[model samples]
Target: MDYAKTERADALAAGYVAGTLRGPARRRFEALLPGHPALRAAVRDWQDRLMPLTASLPPVAPPPHVWAAVERQLWPTVAAAAPSPWWQRLAPWRALSGLALVAVVGLSVLLATPPPAQAPVVVVLQSTGKDPAVAGSLVASFSGDGRAVVARPITPVAVTTDRALELWWAPLEGKPTSLGLIRADGVTVLSRGRLPGGLRGSGIDHMAVSVEPPGGSPTGQPTGPVVFYGKLQL
Candidate 1:
């Protein structure tokens, strides 16, 4: 169904859910939701129905205390209903602490060690020469032989492209993975996304990209040519 009813407000309403409407359109929707229950319901319904198609996924189970936390969220007047203190009840803390300490050590090692300039993990994003393209260095790390990532977008490139630019991470190993697309604006904080199976620390030797269609490579693989490719030499 066409979401917009030719009404300015309805058009904004549709854009809010579809995520196509931004800035003023988004603000207008927020202002409209509470006063407009039908609009709210429409957005919620669209969210519930079309949400599966989007990138957001269901949550993994939180700790047992999470239910109490939810209670706190929904019913603030109610006290946290925990029979025992989590730290005392769970003996797993000792093991977890040990792991955490080991992680700290590993991270220290990583911080101290610099990546070789020739590493395969270093991938550059190449774009049309007409516009100043985003330069980035993708670093592949691993925990217990699983590929983890640390992508640092370099800003030195004098970006001058008219088309709104965004950065997407596509894994060379398995299915094209999303490292969250960048916003056209310079400072979009792309949250850490789910890691690919082969990328958990092994088999991830390189990274590639096809110019994504706007929000990203719509087909999940690069529909555009591999603008930039690199490998992990670390």
Candidate 2:
């Protein structure tokens, strides 16, 4: 009932929205929802904020290899000894060239199966330089779970000793939010909180890099020209 004023309630509502609250905690939350309007509203707010991300993802069927792996785990001996599907066991019918054709067909079936799901997204940030003389780029890759992102310079970026390169989350409909100061030539990991929530859902408008004073932007907003930018491909 006092969910609005408590950190614990907010966390529970978030976990519920994310579907990570399980078993007894989940049941308790559900039971509380009917008695506490504020708690129910809090859960609804989280759902509204996060559902689009989960909903937009298309369902992916597990690859054939996955089922094979499962079978091997459950019945290792049986899977290992399973007949070579009739085609691999075709040597007995060597006189018939038709057996070779059958083997080819079977092998084709196995090989033609679709590859596994794609890995997480990685964005390539290219120099926004208009002149050919300036060259710099960066690669931003999200963690496998999409909980964090890291940026690495692909081409060297030069910055003055008194300035730093800063990263920003350029949203679709608002001012860009500062991520943090990034290195000119090394890896820069953005904390999960700094990443735009939209990136996990619909997608971010873009990510940009700017040259700023050491320690970062003094205004909490970019004060320098955007030198490079790129969109996240989910």
Give the Å shift of residue 189 in candidate 1: 4.6
Task: Give stretches of model 1 more than 4 Å off.
Answer: 1-150, 158-175, 183-189, 197-202
Lowest-sum lDDT 10-residue window in model 1: 136-145
lDDT score for candidate 1 against the true structure: 0.46
Candidate achieving the largest TM-score: 2
* Candidate 2: tens digits of C-alpha lDDT, residues 1-234: 366564446556766765557789899889888987778777876566545433544568886999999999999999989877655566666636777686899899879975443345556566787433335666666654555777777557777688788888765788888878888878888878666453655356788888888989999998977888876544
Q: Which parts of model 2 are misplaced by more than 4 Å?
A: 1-118, 130-134, 196-198
lDDT of each: 0.46, 0.71
Error of 2 at 127 (Å): 0.5
> Over the stretch 135-177, how does candidate 1's per-residue lDDT look in tens digits?
4222222222233333333333332353223344344546555
